[model samples]
Target: MFIRGGNMRILFVFIASILMALGGLPQQTESAKILATLSMPGRSQYIFVENYLKALAARGHQVTVINPFKNNKATPNMRFIEATKVQEYAQEMLTEMDGSNMWQEFNGYTRLMEKINSCTLDDEAVQQLLKSGETFDVVLAEMIEAPPLYGLAQHFNATLVGFSSYGTDFRIDRIMGNISPVSYNPMIIAPRTDRMSFSERLTNHYEYLLEQVHRELVHLPAMERQYKKYFPRAQKTMDEVLDSFALVLLGQHFSVSYPRPYMPNMIEVGGLHIAHKPQPLPEDIKEFIEGAQHGVIYFSMGSNVKSKDLPQETRDTLLRTFGKLKQRVLWKFEDDQLPGKPANVLIKKWYPQPDILAHSNVKIFITHGGLLSTIESLYFGKPVLGLPVLYDQHNVERARRIGFGLGLDLHQLKQEELEAAIHKLLSEPSYAKASSQISERYRDQPQPSLERAIWWTEYIIRHQGAPHLRAASRDLNYIQLHSLDTLFVLVGVPLLIVGLLLKLSCRLLRGSKPKSCPFADKQKKQ
Candidate 1:
């Protein structure tokens, strides 16, 4: 109780050291639980889920992937939640519609939308998974279609992160108050000078409005009624849940996308699924690439398009053009045989695209202009000869106009024109230079896209939800966001006054003022 001054100071120093040590101790890393939902079993989806889960798991986190697939043989660290059969949906729809033109395509899409809209999160299998008592910090749902995933997020009181596989327009519109549902076809959605006219724009808007009305009034209400029939206790409406949710993680790059205003939470994490390490090329493919004296031309129609589906006329034209090119060609075709032998062209069913693009000998890429392919071409600093088949290809081409002048439409494609474009891309240095400039911009990203995505996801979890990142667009009316109301107030009000004064002057002598009341005279005297 009775201590000397020197001893008291020493005791204080000892206490302070202990407190400092305690304060500087490393914070305990919490085990984060995430539920990742991929609607279908596809290479792209698989890669994205796998990489994201791996990244999370590597950082001492737990990931559970829920998909239509039952095969859980891939990664050991993560858990899998198998849903009831849904692959049959796609198979049946594809069979029913077949590959048809735009009108038929719309009909097919409508049918599929109806089918997906029927699914509920409270199904027996879904409930069984929930019974395990596993709680998640966040629900990462793929933007396949509007589903009960948002409801699940609400039920768990967890953050909802939308993993968008498409471009910004439709998804951005969905996040905002715009209820118009536009069909996403790169070929059509991507604005083209030759294809999209003023009338077409009006038609697109009308179509979107009709689709939204159908979904909200007819489709979603019916689904909710059906879900209530299955689960009597489910109280939330699908529309309320979807509209209330914020944060859209888009799988798109600004370099490949057209200029548009976006919400703060609308992040462009394009190429997140791209493999970091290059896969080895087969011996024959290696030899073929090596054999080219000038350079190699790589041609692929992306993941969806099968080369066998190409029309005979188109195939023949492509082959003939390849025959004339001085550089060797690598064609990714499913078929083994060709009509005529082109000495320089090598045909293969598959090619390691990223690896080939990274190759020094690869001078040009002839692509169908899928977003991923276009971005990769830009990432590798190579000029693209786009033969856009469908979906956002037109948009990609339009965006590319600012930099590389290498995009060509499939409709305008001919042997002569194809040859001319290819020759120009190869011979002209500007295309390559422009492409490289884009690649530099892409390479100079603040961080790797996947890391940025992971950081944001974790940050959301830590903060209970990063509401600050959500864009003001969600709360703003169209007029307010675009300043249309302000413009009208400033310009229209002045113009209206001038017009009224002119009309009044016309009715009286030119220099005469309009009759004033006693109130005006009183105010002037005051």
Candidate 2:
């Protein structure tokens, strides 16, 4: 009886193995073609692009990436396409102009548009892409501003997917819909009372108008001229063509952002940065983190800002503040030397930010409030002390006010204030609690962000550009797109029509009763 039972178990194992083999458990085909463009190199943007491409290749797809790097450096299973030489004219124009504040942003935009307009459609990058031996099923463009690649995607008649490095701001949606490309950060969670504030509303209104003017008066004309020059054979207007078929994959998670209405194609795919397995910290950094006694505070201004650019007085104030703090400080300063070294402070040009945040000894992150930094702190369940410098940093820091984090203006930094903010964060535990709650929400998402991005990219290819997801802006006219004017016209028109009719009716009644028509007089006599 025991032998018979053993024989039955063996049979069950054999059958299960056979079933697994027959099911074709790989679950994906090996030869599907995908083309991805990474317009920037050696930046966080490239990192996100590389990961997504790797994910696709792992899923049995043939992936080719177009990287702008000229040094022939790239990962396995990826190809690099050298971008065209930037025009000297554009460069000189940008240099001669003083770009300060919002005007600087516009100057950058103009230069970019000029470059796009000047680029030849048959440039080496575009030719190599078209002539590449493999037939691509789909093309994904990294940013809204990558004109040559966006043009190439059109030329190849492949499905176009837009990957935004920022969150799903309404302005990006407008660009995809051919409405207007305004700048906004959807990651900021504005409180109801704050949104209603007169100052806030006024700022919003001014931004909206400024965006519209920039798009209609400044950007669109240049885009149209470029479209005509590069894609003359194309039938549709630049506006219509851009809006025809596209999807926006934002690098943000819904959990951390404010609740707002989003279209189906505008997907939230944050935490793609954290999707990969964490790398082990180097021995020196590991030892420093392990040896901390009163906990550690991580400070970084992110990649774009140079710590050396900070004024000497500001740097001295920061160093002094760190000296007073009981916690050990890790400052990501580019320079090795400080005027006075704090006993507990360690200065490194760069730090393995994620690994350090994961450490138990780390207590708070002092940041420039860049979106990625803020999100990373939230991902690791650590609170932030934001020092906003430029661009959307203001929006990011303000948004964090919804939670337990604190924001400090970079322009208002004083030794006492910095010390006070740092001390408060160390003593209070609620900030960490709030951050962890957000982290839990992020973890509870249905699937990892990279997986969602890959699935959507492939799904669009499978369904022939996913036309069903495209938004229809044809129903929207000039007045409708700008609706405040439409409301005034709708109300004003009815009142005018009623007044005109009343006057006409009164004139007819008076004419019939007394003087004007002979027929009216004859009828009255009868």
Best by lDDT: 1
Error of 1 at 413 (Å): 5.3
The 10 consecutive residues of candidate 2 with the worst lDDT sum are: 186-195
Whole-model lDDT per candidate: 0.68, 0.68
Which runs in model 1 stand beyond 4 Å of their true positions? Answer: 1-29, 40-42, 45-50, 68-73, 81-107, 116-133, 155-157, 170-188, 192-232, 244-246, 275-283, 335-348, 403-413, 468-526
Extract clashing residue pairs from model 1.
185-391, 186-391, 186-392, 187-391, 190-395
Per-residue lDDT of 199 in model 2: 62
Query: 187-217 in candidate 1: lDDT tens per residue?
Result: 2344452334567566666755665566565
TM-score per candidate, chains pooled: 0.73, 0.79
lDDT of 1: 0.68
* Model 1: residue 296 alpha-carbon error in angstroms: 1.3
**How would you encode candidate 2's per-residue C-alpha lDDT over 144-199 as one tens digit per residue?**
55454466566666677778766755556665554422223321323222234566
